[model samples]
Target: MSLLAHGNSILEVEVTNISTHGVWLFAHGEELFMSYDDFPWFREVAVKSIVNVEEQSPDHFYWPDLDVDLTREIIKHPERFPLKSKSR
Candidate 1:
C-alpha cells in the first residue's frame, strides 16, 4: 500500500520485508530495520497496523499505528538521541 501525508503528500517508505518479528521499511534511498522487540506495540500485530507513514518533510516520518514518529537524521545519527534505544 501507499502512505500519504497532510496535503496528500506521498511518503517514500516501502515495505521491503515482513515477518513475525517485524517489518523492514525502505525510504530515503536507504533501508531501515524495525523490530517488535523495541517497538513492543507492533509485537504480534499484522503489517496493516502500519496504517500510514507521513514524510511530513524531507527527513521526518510519522507512523499512526505505534503513535510514534521519527526522522532520517535521528536514524542516521542515533547517538545524538542517546536517551532513545534501538531494537536488539
Candidate 2:
C-alpha cells in the first residue's frame, strides 16, 4: 500500500522560534532569522500574533494579526529595502 500524503503540504512557512532579539522562520526546508533590528514589527507583538503566519504565495508570508507582509527576499536582505514602517 502507498502512504498517504499530507493534507496541506503546500503550507510550508511557519514561525519556529521567537526570542527577545528576533524570530525564526522555517520555509521550504530552510530556516531564516529576522532580528528585531530589521523586523521591528515583530519585536513587540504577542506570541499568538507572531505565530499566526500564512503563506500568501511562494516566498511570501503574511501575519494577519500584526497586519504585516514579507517576502523571502525582504527577509534575506533587509538592507535592500531600508524604509521600514515607523513604530506604532
Candidate 3:
C-alpha cells in the first residue's frame, strides 16, 4: 500500500541534521546543506535553535528561534552571494 498527500500539501521546512561542518535542511522535496563557512551564525548556536525552521513563503525560509532567515536559492548556491551575513 502507498500513502498520498491527500488534501493539503506538506509545505514545511525543517532542519534535518547538524554537523561539525554545517547544517542540513529538508524542504520542498530537497535536502539542502548550509556550511558554517558561508553561514557562520549556526556554528555556535544551540541544537534547539538549529533545528527550528519554518517556510514563510515558497522560496523563503525563516528560523524564529535564532532569528535567521534564508532563501532556497541561497542555500543551494551560496557562492553567488559574496558578502557574508548579508542583510535578508
Per TM-score, the best of the predicted structures is 2
Clashes in candidate 1: how many?
Answer: 0
Prediction 1 TM-score vs. true: 0.60
- Mark the regions of model 1 whose C-alpha exceeds 4 Å error after superposition: 1-11, 73-88
Model 2 C-alpha lDDT per residue in residues 1-88, reported as the tens digit of each score:
0112576444467788998889999988899999999988998778989888888878989889889999999999999999797654
Task: Rank the models by lDDT, top first.
Answer: 2, 3, 1
Candidate 3 Cα lDDT to native = 0.80
TM-scores for all candidates? 0.60, 0.86, 0.80
Best-first order by TM-score: 2, 3, 1
- Number of the top-ranking candidate, with lDDT as the measure: 2
Where in model 3 is the C-alpha error above 4 Å? 1-11, 86-88
By summed lDDT, the worst window of 10 consecutive residues in model 1 runs over: 79-88
Query: Which digits, one per residue and each the tens of the lDDT, describe model 3 over residues 1-88?
Result: 0112676556477778899999998876799999999998788888988877777778698878778879999889999976777422
